[model samples]
Target chain A: MYPNDGFRELDRQECLRLLAKVPVGRIVHTRQALPAVLPVNFSLEEDGAVVLRTAAASELVRAVDGVVVAFEADEVDAATRSGWSVVVTGPAGVVTDPGEHERLVRTGPRSWVPWPQEVFVRIEPELVTGRALVGGRSLYGVRPPKWIPARR
Target chain B: MYPNDGFRELDRQECLRLLAKVPVGRIVHTRQALPAVLPVNFSLEEDGAVVLRTAAASELVRAVDGVVVAFEADEVDAATRSGWSVVVTGPAGVVTDPGEHERLVRTGPRSWVPWPQEVFVRIEPELVTGRALVGGRSLYGVRPPKWIPARR
Candidate 1:
């Protein structure tokens, strides 16, 4: 871990490795112009892609398939105030190849919800970034950001 | 919990209650038309607004202050494969009220990071939604979503 700032930027490879350590994450996609996030159970492949199973009727499948989205996961210790987060952003598409789809159906990440989640979405990572808060410090820098409310 | 689909929809009140139960969450915001998520430690007020502390120089501070963003938190039982998630969306602004800011600094949610973290960002929630998967069934539906690879 980086020592000075207590915050270290993780490289792409490190990000992927960290992702494999966790089974759950949040997927972020744009609804209109606002960003929406949904929790998902995902697995990382050897090639750095993320595979997730979701409900066919869920909003994520209807709107996010084939769209650019972001997947994020992290492990944090609240008491220690230390944790690392990895985010993968790329196009999320339905698994189309029959052979691969069959394999994923049997081996891909499992879902926790009971709804019929036949939809298998794969996020091909275009960019990966991560950061860790080390030294048990939750805040960074010498001071906190200024929050000034507007008089509207 | 909702009995049939093993999916239960939580109300706004319950969503806020759950937020208080977890000290960490992910904040989702749009940065230059791309969605970015960052893990943060936060606290909830009785009014349902969410408050957090961050460094002045952080990307979250620069990009999310006075912006509308989505904050999500969840806890899943790995063994049981059951969990719940809550998402809050609203406009985040710097606490301009001196009295509130001071109170938050003293009694508000504390940060794990050691930086001064004097900067307090408050997200006044416009929408709060949540869902829970109970009864421990990790896989959903009788049949998963259909996946077919494009023939290119």
Candidate 2:
């Protein structure tokens, strides 16, 4: 991590690592020129693609096919006032190959929502970026405010 | 909540009520024609506007002033496979009036990032929509698969 301002920039590998760790993220796509953000259960694959399952009737399944979209995932600790966030931008391609779809279903993150999530989509990342706020480290190495509790 | 498929739609008042309960959300905006999704700590006002603080040098402060943006917030239960999400769309107007800015600072959500967050942006919602997946309810009213865990 390279510190920039009070946050540090994470390398691509670190960003992908974190992306794989989290099961839920928000996918941002444009609908009729207006941006729409939807939460999704997604998984990162070995080739750096992000995969997600959705219902066939989902608006996302319809709108995001072959479209450039943004995926964002993060974890924040309110008690410690710190967290890491990653964003990936890419083209969202629907998984149409039956064999590939079957493999993805067995490997990718599953939706927590109880719906028929039969459609699979993959995002081939064009850009990956991330930032982290190290719990006890300020930009200039000053002591944190007493009000901020230390992490366990 | 009126059921649509396996999800239920929440009205405006219910949407705002849920928005006020969460302190963090992802704000979506367009940057150079591409959608940018950012994690932000935000709060809701009595009149249904959303407010958040960011550093003056932040890209969000530069890109979102007087622009329409999408804000999404949600909570999910991993154990019960249930969740609810709310999305708000509106113009993100920078709070420039001194009294108004101060009042927002006194009540709006504060950033946990260790930087000087001097810019305040408010999103007065023009459109609000939300959906919730109630626990124990399937779309077809059939018993959920045994793979699905029961609510604790």
- Model 2: how far residue B126 lies from native, Å: 1.1
Query: Considering only N, C-alpha and C atoms within 3 Å, which residue pairs clash in candidate 2?
Result: none
Instruction: Per model, state how many residue pairs clash.
Output: 12, 0
| Predicted candidate 1 versus true structure: per-residue lDDT over B32-119, tens digit per residue | 6677887777888888888888665555666788888988888876556567888888899878798988898897777554354456
Residues A1-152 of candidate 1 have per-residue lDDT tens digits of 11133457789888988998887788888775677887667878888899987655555676678888988888987765567888898899988798998898788976543343466789998888887655421354553222111111
**Estimated TM-score for each candidate:** 0.82, 0.84
Q: State which docking tier applies to candidate 2.
A: acceptable
Stretches of model 1 off by over 4 angstroms after superposition:
A1-5, A111-117, A136-152, B1-6, B114-117, B137-152
Per-residue CA lDDT of model 2 for B52-115, tens digit only, reads 8766666666678888899998887646656788989889987889999888778877655445
Runs in model 2 lying further than 4 Å from the true structure: A1-5, A111-117, A137-140, A143-152, B1-5, B111-117, B138-140, B143-152
Worst 10 residues of 2 chain A by lDDT: A143-152
